[model samples]
Target: MNVDGALAPAVESILRTARERTPGEDAERISVDARSFSDALADAEENGRVPLIAEVKPTSPTTNGERTDDPVELAETMVENGATALSVLTEPEHFGGSTENLRRIREAVDVPVLRKDFIVREEQLDAVAADLVLLIVRFVDDLEGLLSAAEERGFQVLVEVHDEEELREALDAGATIIGVNNRDLARLEVDLGTFESVAPVVPEDTTLVAESGITTTADVERMCDAGADALLVGSAIMDGDVGENTRRLVNA
Candidate 1:
């Protein structure tokens, strides 16, 4: 509940935005006929390929400049190169993201869109047009309630965890899809071992996604060997050739 570390600023900024929203704004929601995000990852695994969830992040707290000016174009290129899903940052200010970009990317691609943001309350889920949403267990008090709320809104929740305790909380909350973030919010440092350490404890039935610190094909191979069903790559793909970099990871 006491937000701190690398996520403190983002969590603070997102809460203000969540508070400003008028409740029930999505009462007459225009539903998106979303593709199943979990199924997409599972299908990739079943077909003997590690799934990829390429991100559409323009900027981040850790980066200095904008990664791309046109998110839709970048998203299309990623999918063309075999990305299974897309994660779009929706938190502005620190992340240089917006809901407009999420909507635009979702329209440009048929793959499922993940609204990657610091979601602390159910109110934030209102008006989210994406097929999936992210919920960090460290920032949430009632993980179960928020998970239920997201599912009720017709969005699959990718419960994020940084370590063992948070992973336990996610499992207790009945999370089916889990993303192990290698970047520690406390120090903004990434250690690939974080996923490797947590992966074995996660139930085989749960879809596990390895996030952060993955850039090269070797890194992708390492994660797959460690039991990652999918990889959520951001800075690595955005900082260079989008299509080429994505292809390298996809073929890895």
Candidate 2:
């Protein structure tokens, strides 16, 4: 289902909370142990395949129903099924995820965990035991500063982009991991060719992560063939047996 304007209000609320919070008082801070998300992806390659960062989002505006139970169980299953890394949604309102999910998933699995959210404040970054954080290049004003800040706090950055201009901004900000989101925010439609189009301009040394709209082994192979170093898949993997679904992605 299309959710073109659905994301707007949720994002605005989070950004507002980020702006209103005082330093070291975010109340959302959970754990402080750090892991290297970039290194884990580099280690997940097998037969020259792209690594998988299996995500643990309970729900999203694009889909219906909620996954309020067994998030940790699902997370462990993904890790057990050869997940290179883990992505736990920390955005509460729209995604129905909590920092508790991130912290416990980190403790539950040894793999790197990425706090996937629309982060706008340093305090927000301090709220997880996450190895890395998703810094959407579209929402952040100082991409370079946020990149540096996350690195300084022991977390790597996944700079997400939806178009060429945002891709350039991520590159210009010295981002080591760049995520090409296929879902167009304005139209709320996914186009895999988005990654095919934007990936060529990215340098080989950078880890190119493909996000959203992938559902099958064919999609996985297509992304791998298109030069995605890693894939961040959530909804599809959540829709079936976690282990089998993840293995399909890894083998693809």
Off by over 4 Å in 2: 1-33, 47-50
lDDT of 2 by residue, 1-252 (tens): 112244555455665664554425546544445676666766776345459999998898787787766899999988888889989988777788888888788888898888888787666677666788889877777888888888887777889998788888888889988999998776567999999999999999998999999998999989988998889999988876888988888777
Q: Per-residue lDDT of 109-199 in model 1, one digit per residue for the tens?
A: 9888899987777777765588988998877878999899788778888999988888898998999999999987766789999999999
- The residue-level lDDT of candidate 2 at 18 comes to 49
Cα RMSD, model 2: 3.7
Residue pair clashes in candidate 1: none
Whole-model lDDT values for every prediction:
0.84, 0.81
Model 2: lDDT equals 0.81
Clashing pairs in 2: none
| TM-score against native, each model | 0.90, 0.88
How many angstroms is residue 84 displaced in model 1 relative to the true structure, after the best TM-score fit?
Answer: 0.6
Q: Model 2, 55: alpha-carbon shift in Å?
A: 0.6
